[model samples]
Target: MKLTFWGAARTTTGSFHLLETRGKRIALDCGLFQGRRSEFFERNRDFPCPPADVHATLLSHAHIDHCGNLPNFVAQGFEGNVFGTNATMDLARTLLLDSAYIQEKDTQFVNKIRARKDEPPVNPLYTVEDVEPCLDLFVEIGYYRTFCFAEGFCGRFIEAGHILGSAQVQLDVEQASGAQHRLVFSGDIGRAGRDILRDPEIPGEAQTLIMECTYGNRPTEPIEGLREELRDLVTRVADRGGKIIIPAFSVGRTQDLVYQLSLLFREGALPQIPIYVDSPLSANVTEIFRNHPECFDRETRDLLRKEHNPFGFETLTYIRDVEESKALNELKEPAVIISASGMCEAGRILHHLRNSIHDPKNCVLIVGFQAEHTLGRRIVEKRPKVRIFGEEHPLRAEVKVLNGFSAHADRDELRDYAFRVQTRSGGMLERIFLVHGEKEAGEDLASYLREALGVEVHFPERGDTFEL
Candidate 1:
């Protein structure tokens, strides 16, 4: 069998790998490359391989960087089965539609600018029409259950704990003589015992492994520290009679916020104030989470045991409609409103920030990873002013970050997981290919693995291949 690192090899976005075995081909992930518009658009709009020739697709999760290009694959004439867990399918149902909407809207916006510049208008990479066919191709694989695709290959989806339905993929290949080979691909791993998600399921053993190292150079703040910090913010905002706005990712971070708020409210740590979830996608995702009780950790289950609702409380309101969401701006009293698009890039959160930022009393509590050049990072840096909708506004609102709420595993956590795997497998994972991170992070994780586990780690470049 041969494996090719097509995307996310030298960069952090677009996650994809091509696997060839026994006269057939399988794709591990089909994701969009996210970066500068022109570069990102061109890279994602084209496939390195013939899309129609692929036999199957094994999805890790529904994050755009991981599963974003499935529709494009369909658009390019791939009709193979795409596999993920039930929760992945649920999240993809929301994420793919949202992505399609963005793609169409982006094309329209870009075309208008092109018309002004006297340049030819370009078409969207894919649209709702493309998303529909891709949705039809999804076949949900239950966690831990093996499913056969083409000859010489069988795979199972393991819980990755990054978000609802995130998974690590393992493939088993057998020949006619009954000799077997195993490969494990660690999808973006999350911290254990976070919110409603189950712990990342550990792979017992495998001959080869591919892993992610997103936070390889940093150690996350303790979860208890985050809880205390949030409590303090709540007490401060309530005492001052001011509102707090949180811009977080809709999938994992939003759910964590609700669950933690419920926990704090239960412990008498929160004051009586309104909490509004302003994203319709988050509200829908929350419903999907409620449907998967089996994914809950003990702490989340314990909270549910008494309160009967781990993600809901008396003060919480989920706003879905445009009018209802607009009405939130009329709120004059102290409250907390959580919105999506984490980066404060393009969302209703911008409106909230614009309205509340000039007032020193209002707080913008940031609780997710802010990429470089994003508005969220600028807020964290306390830039004097930031541009919003082509206008610059003063940055008077207090910006506080709670790093403990991060979904990805930090360096220490990744090392611990690596050692745990090392001990269990008796050094079976001799070669580890690190992907889905910046070059420095990949290099740092490689050194750590070599120093601690005495294993050879390779940081493959884009289009790099290995024979095993």
Candidate 2:
């Protein structure tokens, strides 16, 4: 068998990996790369391999960075079954359609500016028309059920604990020489004790492991302190009659924040202030979350049994119509508004940031990883000015980041997970490959694994390929 690093290879955004065996190719993920605009378009618009040649595609989760480019892949002529868990298939349906809509909208926005500057208009990577066919190719596989891709190949999906329907893939291959091997792909490992989702399932055994190291260099704040920190921030903003604007991802991060806030409100720890989820995509994704109680953790399931609707309350409102979303800008009272496109790059979050970021009384909260060169990074860096929708905006809002809300596992947790896999495999886990992280993060984790776990690790670059 052969493996190729197509994306997320020394960087965190695009996550494509190609595996070849028995004259056929399989892609683990085909995610959109997010970064500098020119590079993002060039990378996401094209696939390194001919899409038609691929036999199958297995999706790990529905996050845009992991499953965002499926439409583009299918548009390029790949005609194979896309396998995922039932929840993953359902969530991916919404996420991919939303992604396509965003692409078309963002392209129109950029084209208008380009036309004004006498530059050629760029095309959207994929559109809603392209997403429908991709959805038709989706096939649902239940967790722990093994499915055959070819005569000598089969795999199982283990609970990954990152988001609803996320899974760690385990592939078993039978070589022509009658030798057998197990390969595991750790798709965005989640925190063990994070709220709402269960802890990552233990990877039973494997010979070769490909894992993500998104937080390899950063240690998260104590989980116990997350609620108190959030409560204090919200309380301060409300006391000053100011808005709290949060840039969160629609899938996991947004739901996590809503769940935490619900807990605080139920316990009377937080003041009664109106809370709005401003993105239509988030509202849709939350509905998907409601349908998948099997994905919930013990705590969340308990809450669901009692409250029936853990994501709703008297003060909580989900904004779907554009008029309602725009009305949020007109409100003068204190409120907490959570918006999507977490990097502050797109969606209603841009409008919310533009309207509220200039006020010293207002606060902007960042609750997820901010890749380099993103608007979120600029805010985290406390830049004096930021450009939104091609206009300069003052950055006077108090910018606060809480690392405790992150879904990815930190350095120590990753090390522990690797050790557990190693121990469980009884030294059969010979090769470990780290992907889905920045250069520094991959390097740091590589050193830690080499020194602490004494495992042979490799950090593959984009376009790098290895035969095993």
Scored by TM-score, the top model is 2
Candidate 2 local Cα displacement, residue 389, angstroms: 2.1
- After TM-score superposition, what is the CA distance of residue 199 in candidate 1 from its true location, in Å? 1.5
Pairs with backbone N, CA or C atoms under 3 Å apart (clashes), candidate 1: none
lDDT of 2 by residue, 1-468 (tens): 899998899988889999987788889977888887769878987777899999989988888888888888888899999998889999999988888887788788878977898989888778899999999999999999999977788989999999999999999988767689899999999988888888898786799999999998878887888999999999999999899999999889888898889889988999889999987887678788878888888988998788667777778999888899999999899999999898987788888998999999999999999988788999999999998877789999999999899888988888889999999999798889999999899999999898887878999999998888
Model 1: residue 398 alpha-carbon error in angstroms: 2.2
| TM-score of predicted structure 1 | 0.90
Provide the RMSD of all predictions against the true structure, rounded to 1 decimal. 2.8, 1.4
lDDT per residue for candidate 1 within 438-461, as digits (tens), equals 777889988989888888788899
**Alpha carbon lDDT of each predicted model:** 0.83, 0.89
What lDDT score goes with residue 10 in model 2? Answer: 91
